[model samples]
Target chain A: MDFLSVLQFAFVQRAFLGGCVIAVLCAVLGLFLVLRKMSLIGDGLSHVSFGAVALGLLANMSPLYVALPLVVLASFVILKLTEKGRLYGDAAIGIVSALGIAGGVILASVSRGFNVDLFSYLFGNILSIGNEELALAVALSAVVLVVVAVFYNDLLAVTFDEEYARVSGIKTTRVNMLLMALTAVTVVLAIRVVGIMLISALLILPAATALQLARGFKGALLISALTAVTAVVAGICVSIALDLPAGGAIVAVNLVFFLAALGFKKAAV
Target chain B: MSAVISAEQLSARYNSVDVLQEISFEASAGDYIGVAGPNGAGKTTLIKALLGLVDISGGSVKLFGESLQRFGQWHKVGYLPQRASFSLLFPASVKEIVGLGLLTQKRTPKRLSSGDAALIDAALELLGIGSLRKKLIGELSGGQQQRVLLARALVARPEVLFLDEPAAALDPQIRESFFDTIRALNRDARVTVLLVTHDIGEIGQHATKLLYVDKRVVFYGKFTDFCVSTEMTDFFGTHSQHLICHQHR
Candidate 1:
């Protein structure tokens, strides 16, 4: 079947709709996270989600319900570590990431082994996404996008210089918390599209690629969003054609875009 | 005269060590006070404390008659921190950088309007950086980058401007031009300025008052009083004191 005919399947339509929304959410939040050097946040939170998912499976509960709150809490813990622990961003992320993987490993062993249901989450199964998951992704993505748009100026100010933004009466603490919370939610949502192992690529690559050529802040955001959506759509199509894992395919496509952007930047210079 | 800034028994600490101790002073409208001190003397800490950027360990600070905690009129204040504090390579344009100054004037969903755009243009022109408005901030030279930050501070037309070593990285010629622009703003625009610098001798040329501190208020008064005071003469010694006051004469 051709690509257009492939779109007629219910699962394919749901996957495209859900994947595109999550990709845009990741890209938009990624720009700020990448700029602030908090790109590892997605990876850290996803690791926490891995632990949360294991706990949920062991408890015979839905993993998404368990992972959301647990990951959000982990993000705040990371924020507090950076604030009061006198640690760098990477160090804080590293500590949380290690703890997450360890917790997940322990939980996996206690549960007698990694089950089939757990395997699906580890490597993602986007084509198996149900209507409920699709709806959840779209709604959360809209909320994240609106929050980003509403606080665009404040986010830009804080990202550029936190002290200056605070002196201007922009609530730097609140904005930082909001950014972290939004990132956590995006990471949890993106896991279904790209899996826990490759979620960071979905959160980082598009923004990095856009930064290579974008001249202005808004242009960078626009380019990043477009890059993310394009990668998701093209990756999904390629996965169906080649009978490959969708998550790996999406990340691979993003890597290709990043390499191309780097080449373009070098040539232009 | 009504005070623009008031600090009483103000103190700050870093890692449990006192950076500022019982520092008390007041700045009136249009007063140009030059803040000078040795390295690690808490000059930057004092600025940070006054602006509520750091925790106050002891007393209190008031801005525009309101206590620091209650003061919400940030548009009335401008801060140009040390150049090293900025992330210049963040892919922002000159206009975009300057537009940040006006964000305090807006509420949630803060955006630059067409009128705000006009103000940004005027600020860039005032700093002689209008041609660089479309240019990326990181691509600019050190002098130009400094100008962009100055425009960001100036765009909102703040009544009180706090500059922390703004000309530290400039060439002699550029430094003079920068000081001239500040002096003009103080003289023509009647804007209050608290300039933190290491150049005591150079600051004596334009500042109406001088505030010298090394973790405490060493001296705070007009240049004339500082020049004639036997106490300052004894503290700084005749030759060193004379070097600071020569430009005022």
Candidate 2:
């Protein structure tokens, strides 16, 4: 089957649109997360979303409806713990991540084991993304990308030297909170594309690849976004051709790009 | 001359332990005040507190006659932190780093305009770093990096500049040039300067006044007063005091 004929399917179109939006969101936010040393946050939030999904499934409701707020709350808990300066960021993320998985496991056991829907969310089923999910991804991407654009300088300032940013009157605290909130929403949106098992890879790999050869901050951001979108599109095509899992295929493609970037850096040096 | 910075009975804490206690002082326009103290003397804390970077456990701070809590004119202030505290490897160009100084003057939805770019270029040129604008920050040498940071602090042309050991990491040649630039700004542009340094003797050459601190005000007066005062001689041994005040003499 040719690539053009593959686009004939509505499910394929929806998957491409939804996956690309989520990929871009993850890529942009992932660079900041990686720079700020909060790369584990996406994994932590996805675990929380897992617990939320279990709760929603048990209650016979849509998983996303429950997962969004619950994951956001978890991300804030991590943020507050880090903000208090008592606990390290990784430790806080670890604590919340452990609790989330534990809750999800307990809920799953209580509900008599994992069903097909739970399994799909565990590894993702991008080809099964509905029109509603696609619309949500596009709308959320628009809002998130715009916010990132508007606050790009502030974010750079806050991430680089928070003390300098504060004295410069950039309102460091507000920008930090805004970043956390945006990451929460993006993590939730990304779950549909990469699922709970590999969400962090989606959030981190593209940025890591970009940083391997990027000349400056803006270049890194642009390269990361492009890498992520390309990975998603190529992953979808490969998944369709080989009848493989889209999430795994996407992560595999990202790994390839990261290796290529590493090779490129070495050759340049 | 009107005071550009004033603090009354200001106190600050770190980990619930007092670092600055009832620190009171005033800096008039164009006043070059050198803040000197031993390690752990809270000189850095005082600078942070004045800028509202650290929480004030007590007292009040005023900048440009506006209370710290109500002061909204941030473009009027600049701060250059200790070089050791900065992250050098962050992915930013020198131009982008200096451009941040202009963000303080922008409102929400802040966007850099062509005018802002011009200002950044001017600041780079002022610091002799115009050629390094496109260079990555981490790729620059220590001296070049310091110049970039200084340009950032000076880019907005702030009325008051706070520098905490700004040249502690530079070579003697670079350090002299850096101090010369700061002194020129204070004398020529009339920008108020509060410089925190460990080298009291070195600072005495440029600063008009001295504010010695060790968790509290040890002394606050003109270089001439500090040089001739019997009390300062008593607090610091005559030999030590003379060593610090020799440049003033």
Best by lDDT: 1
lDDT of 2 by residue, A1-269 (tens): 78689889999989999999999999999999998889999999899888899999999988888888898888889989998858999999999999989999899889985566787888988898998888887898999999999999899988888888888888887898888889989988888888998999998999999888777899989999999999999999999998899999999999999999999989988
lDDT tens digits by residue: candidate 1, A183-231: 9999999889999988999989999998888889999999999999999
> Per-residue lDDT for B29 in model 1?
89
Candidate 2 residue-wise lDDT, B1-249, digit = tens: 457999999999888899999999999998999999999999998998999988899999999999998888899999988753445546778888898898898887777899999999999987777999999888899888888988989999999999999887788987888888899999999999999999999999999999999999999989999988999899999999988877763
**TM-score per candidate:** 0.98, 0.97
How many backbone clashes does every candidate have?
A: 0, 0
How far residue B208's Cα lies from its native spot in candidate 1, in Å, is 0.7
Residue A9 local lDDT, model 1: 98
The segments of candidate 1 whose C-alpha lies over 4 angstroms from its true place after superposition are A1-3
lDDT digits (tens) for residues B121-214 of candidate 1: 9998887788999999889998888888889999999999999988987889888888898999989998999999998998999899999999
